[model samples]
Target: MNSVVELRHLTKVYKSMIALNDVSLSIEQDSIYGLLGRNGAGKTTLMSILTAQNFATSGEVEVFGENPYENARVLKRMCFVRESQKYPEDSKAKHAFANARRFFPHWDQVFAEELIEEFRLPLNTTVKKLSRGQQSAIGVIIGLASRAEITFFDEPYLGFDAVARQTFYDRLIADYAEHPRTVVLSSHLIDEVADLIENVIVIDRGSIIIDDSAEEVRKRAVNIVGDADAIARLVAGREVIHRESLGRVASVTMLGRLSSVDHEYIADANLDLAPVSLQQLIVRTTQEGPVDPSAAATEVRSVQT
Candidate 1:
């Protein structure tokens, strides 16, 4: 199927607060997707509903063209890895793997063993006694080894050091290359995984603010650096997301691609072009509004409007 997961008007309410407000979206097959948003933006709530870990107040949810709630067939094909994943006090890492092997038909024991060693996890240590990083490693190992068709990793890298995080990313890419599946990862480390995601889905205030290909998303904004006067002239009559200045030189990030006229303006004005960071774009768009940097020194000024 073209869409592996679909949600129609999904809504979840906890007393007075609306966790998910009539949200609707779809996930395509065999690609890595980044689910990004501020805390309480309904990101975790949305993924929880998709995995049947929680119930939606109102909506139609489908996985693999079938309702996933309580459906063993669909559940077995999916996996949800999160920092808060708990195991029994007496259970060890091996116990978790043993359970995963039984539940997931595609579970790969050899791969799991390899990951266990790579992450340097103690197989015999009780779950409760393991360090937070070690606990997170267990989740990572299970998620990767499960080999489920649709895996949701909801910030499973908590407590992971820089090296460990990079290892996870490297292994993830290599494994995905060999066995493609739909993977949706939610992380606050935007730029770190920016190169890994094919599609970006952003949620803000319980709603989807941006959903598009990564390439298209990055193209939404461009940075121009040169003399302050020339930069000002270049951005005239255009939407400016941010502007930073140092002495006479300035860097302005705006929300549009260059036109023939704009190109002429850049060349004639001796301006340099730089790529915009995907994280910065999302941060600007999701903020209450553009923030004008302080005039004390060189910084950014968001030209709203």
Candidate 2:
């Protein structure tokens, strides 16, 4: 697959802290990428640099094979829908959409109108007066209607209810099918977007922990359930990510594929195997010490949207 965006040795720093450390990755064209990570995991910083909203401390970034900084040619081909988007104090939702139409050359007014009705957004109300969920809907509408070559949605469903979020997801899938493009979505709700993302990138503590296809990532770990002693012996040499015990029964999540011998042992021990979901796998992979209390604050101050 052709890469629409490339990051080479990308790094970001805030005073004494490193937000992104020697990161290198590629965003393939015409696919949905899930940027899964906890707060202060550099997801926003990476997106900010790609969109030219923020500059990398060091290293290189290429969007559509060219530097995105101050480059209208590249910038116009990408859209960054963020929760912190700002609007004129007096401007209504209509004004925002109209402005978006002007900025996004491929903007579809018809689609925007359809989304407005579907989201039941109030066009007359000033953006500041609208509810948080309603405000988020504005960004979602622009993201879908803009139809940019590479769109970045950074936690776009901030305050949305389950139904509203599902609507966004359903529309995203439907529209993406009819019009394929590169989409980089950053969200904390990992499970909710699991089915939507074709590729998964897990960032942890300023580093890339897992970068692979969703299907492959799902297969990276397996959960074994049975007698505590059997599970302990089976997983003795394996990398255990998570474990649970209930009296004599133990459930353990371990990395790497099971071999024929291991399978036979599991069968002999009457053990059961369960598939790991994307969310659970990610949680276990990134589970560690508490994040720096100042990391989130620094990112908030440094990141531009």
Candidate 3:
């Protein structure tokens, strides 16, 4: 697939702190991508730079093969839905959708109206007076109805309840099926959006760590549960990101795929193997290391017995 956005050795620095460190990646056309990481991990900074909302301290950024800064041609095709969108003091939900229709060339008023009702958002109420979930619903409505070629949702469902959030996801997927576009979703709810995204990009400490298809990233790690000694021996020389033991039973999350022979070995050893979900793998991978070498190399906490 063709790339809709490209970055080469991108870096963003603010005074004494670095927000992005030599980041480089490509966003393919018509794909849903999860821009995931812990807070302060530069996910927002990267999206801000790509959309020309912020400047990169160094390196290059391209959206639709053109610089996004001050480039109306490139900017019009993109829509950025921020977590906390500011509005006019007395503006209502209707006013926001009206403005969105004016800005996004492909905005669908009918779809926007449908979303507004489905989310149960009040059009007459002032935006600021509306509940936080209501405010988030407005953003979700705009993001889905805009139909821009590229849409960036920066934690857009902050205050949505489970049912409301599910509505947003369902609407997004349904709309996207009919009108496929490049979508970069920056979210903390990894498992919630796991199946929605085709690709996953994980950033840690201002740098890109993992960028691959959801299927491939899922195979990056596995949980092996069995005898502590057998697991220690089986996973020896392998990178163990997390481990927990309860008496003699140990469960270790190890990186890398399991070979056919390894599966045989696992079965022979009476070990239970479980696939690590995307959320679990990422949590373990991005964890901060202990200061001591021994602690960092091997950490097996006994939760209970």
Top TM-score model: 3
Per-candidate TM-scores read 0.90, 0.93, 0.94
Number of colliding residue pairs in each model: 0, 0, 0
Error of 1 at 214 (Å): 1.2
lDDT of each: 0.86, 0.87, 0.88
Residue ranges of candidate 3 with Cα displaced over 4 Å? 288-305
Instruction: Indicate the TM-score of model 1.
Output: 0.90
Model 1 worst lDDT window (10 residues):
290-299
Q: Tell me, what's the RMSD of every candidate? A: 5.5, 8.3, 5.1
Q: Rank the candidates by lDDT, best first.
A: 3, 2, 1
User: Please, what are the lDDT tens digits per residue for candidate 3 over residues 95-142?
Assistant: 999998999999998898888889999999999999999999888899
Candidate 1, overall lDDT? Answer: 0.86
Model 3, global lDDT: 0.88
Candidate 1 clashes between residue pairs 3 or more apart in a chain or in different chains: none
lDDT winner between 1 and 3, please give it. Answer: 3
Per-residue lDDT over 235-298 for candidate 2, one digit per residue giving the tens place of the 0 to 100 score: 7755677899999999998777776777778888899999999888888877853323222112
Give a tens-digit lDDT track for model 1, residues 87-153. Answer: 8879998899999999999999999999988999999989999999999999999999999999999
lDDT of 3 at 40: 95
